[model samples]
Target: MPADLCPADAALAARLPQGVLRDPAPAYLEEPRGRWLGQAGLIAAPRDTAECAAIIRACAEARVPVVPRGGGTGLVGGQVMSQGPAPLVLSLERMTAIRSIHPDEGVMIAESGVTLHAAREAAARVGRQFPLSLASQGSAQIGGVLATNAGGVNVLRYGNARALCLGIEAVLPSGEVMHDLKRLRKDNTGYDLRDLLIGAEGTLGIITAASLVLAPVPAETGVALLVVDGPEAALTLLSLAQARMAGGVTAFEMIAGQGLRFLAEAFPEMRQPFPAPPDWSVLIEVGLPDGLSAQAALEGLFAAGVEAGLASDGVIAQSGREAAELWALREHIPLANRHVGAIANHDISLPLSEIARFIADAGAMIAAEGDMRINCFGHLGDGNLHYNFFPAPGRTREDYDQYRKPMTRRIHEMVVARGGSFSAEHGVGRLKAADLAEWGDPARLAAMRAIKAALDPVGIMNPGVILA
Candidate 1:
């Protein structure tokens, strides 16, 4: 077990500009899902990279475990330390800064503490778009987003967080600064360490700042909600949309009727677009160049989908306000899910060819387990789905607690059998470490262990994460 934070560490904390809090508040101890309540010996929020390095150095010398926290919006409990010796929870909440923005070069350097929404607004000020978006954008910080290598609605066009980031400045486990924040698109100098830290869940090091790529705002943007028969038809519609619009398809999300129902039950004030929700529908967005009209492109795609028998009914946004309403429905699905409660939630990805089959087989498999409700939706353009199981109308999740593990295992088994990943966008953290051990490649696991040992010899950076 690692040594606990003692009185001596207090002196070390005082050296930092933001200082430290001995008594951690509820925010530091709790996760979004309320799955795990963490324990911390000390809470240190550093203002800059140097103070962060100093805190890490002190923890390294004392062999004290350090848990790097961002905005605490992680679903996988990566930001929480629940077991082992008490840890010093290092937060980057105070490091919020937009260091620079070069609109001509299409690059922006931002401190890790800046929220995703803030970053987006910063980019918008210069007529550029930071395309990495998520439901938790208002609170999810850059450090956490890059740590987990987040993938959101715009991934179909903009790619994941890793692809959006050009370079990063992180503090190593050994307290050394890796100042590799460059605005270049190509660099093959040596090993790509920036990628190694991103998606490492702060187990490797703390990402302090990043140089991110920006894109010009779309000349013409359009959103449409189309009713599909099922996942199979949705896949077919995706193909048709992509073929018709070419690279203009920016976001394609599949939503089940259950999600719409959940929203009605959870938030009655939120307006529903359709009078009666279809069994299965897709939210599609297309961004066209100056000469092309997004509305015309979507109408063409919709007509093709109708002729192909992939779509039954659809509605294309007529104005910007209507587009915002369309996206609000998609973005609020998670909130609805949380309000209703889930027995088990899965963020998984599969090969496009196998997604339809997996969804059908998995649903049948889960139905046999119990009479549960499933809200299946997500970024169909990229093959990632949020498959969550909820209790029956009159039941609660606590009543089904005994079956959570078995249900999760069964779903994961089906996913793996169908050439899918159990953890897609969400990193392993402590929640999926055992899943990684069970499903991860043996050689790859061994290599990861070696890399962790090399970078964090003392095991001070986020113990009990990724590798079990």
Candidate 2:
């Protein structure tokens, strides 16, 4: 704990509105990974932007750390400040109002507390689609989604959280509310604060509400699971699909055979497409125009892939139920990973050209270190892969604790060398702070530090996060 830092005092409590304060419960202190346990001086759930600003003002005046929390589904330690002076954990649970929905204009203004799932439902109710989809959409809030700039399955077609968001309303570090949630698609304004805070991970400010962009639902959509020879074949097939589809590919995800086996081991009853999982496969989804047939498009893609020796066997979804079933298998992968504990989990991204080499080389490198299982899979179209390491059968993750740091360093080193990011999709929370310090470019690091110092002069916002 810092010497000058203080927890919320009696004065701080009096500053907040009645019913805003709550007990610092265990759920507020824990993250999804169970890697670190946080300590909270207090927990506050403000109902609106004014109350949120008041909470921040009180914390700022008290020189207390303010850790903004949303769904707590974040993999990294951003939501929880494990070691520090106990912070006022600001929860965005009460600000659930969808202020306005402009479906005709293809936009919606929503408070930060609205869950991604709820936002999606609201968009659907108006005959539109909010394209940002995540496995934890039901729990993940819009604030946290933009806070971390989350990337999900549909990033190939629609883009990430940052791209989907048109503007944001946030409470800056000084307790002033930034009410710039404009629904404009084009704004060449000076110093876009919305972008500044979108991926800031609560380091600069707390995002309170946002102007979310909506897209028309695709007229025709189809899904197929294609068996590829390897990552190389998968990349080639992706190129061919793009050339043919002309921006119709909604999501192109690559699944490792090992991931399938892990699913089978963890979920024995779950129905999978293939009789036996191949070494490598891809789950390609296409969304076509009204006149185009999604089934015919996928069928043609499959045939082309087979003729090019990129795919050997596959399964194309016939109905929406079948499509959901196919997607269920992909969505359950993370749950299955948690079922079988992992030694080291990496959410990395690489150049499309380098993914194959990195996968093969990194797999061999990790194998040489110790006995471990690898379940590598993710949004291949976006070059992000959840390359996770697990214990060999009959062993526990505890057995490989010694190799965790060294093996992780090796993997990250290879990724950095190949023009890739060690922390991709998942923000650089407390987990990757050291990596950012060590591997970050000197000039960029200096600018980040300068920005942090200027915006959060008191260092009360998410201390020891990206800067440390």
Report the number of the highest-lDDT candidate: 2
- Minimum summed lDDT over a 10-residue window in model 2 is located at 1-10
lDDT of 1 by residue, 223-315 (tens): 999999899999999988888887889999999999999999988998887899899999999998999999999888888889989998999
Model 1 misplacement above 4 A: 1-23
How much lDDT does candidate 1 score? 0.92
Worst 10 residues of 1 by lDDT: 14-23
Superposed on all Cα atoms, the candidates' RMSDs to the truth, in angstroms, are: 2.3, 2.5
On the 0 to 100 scale, the lDDT of residue 264 in model 2 is 98
Q: For each candidate, what is the lDDT?
A: 0.92, 0.92
Off by over 4 Å in 2: 1-8
Clashing residue pairs for model 2? none
Q: What's the residue-level lDDT of 98 in candidate 2?
A: 95
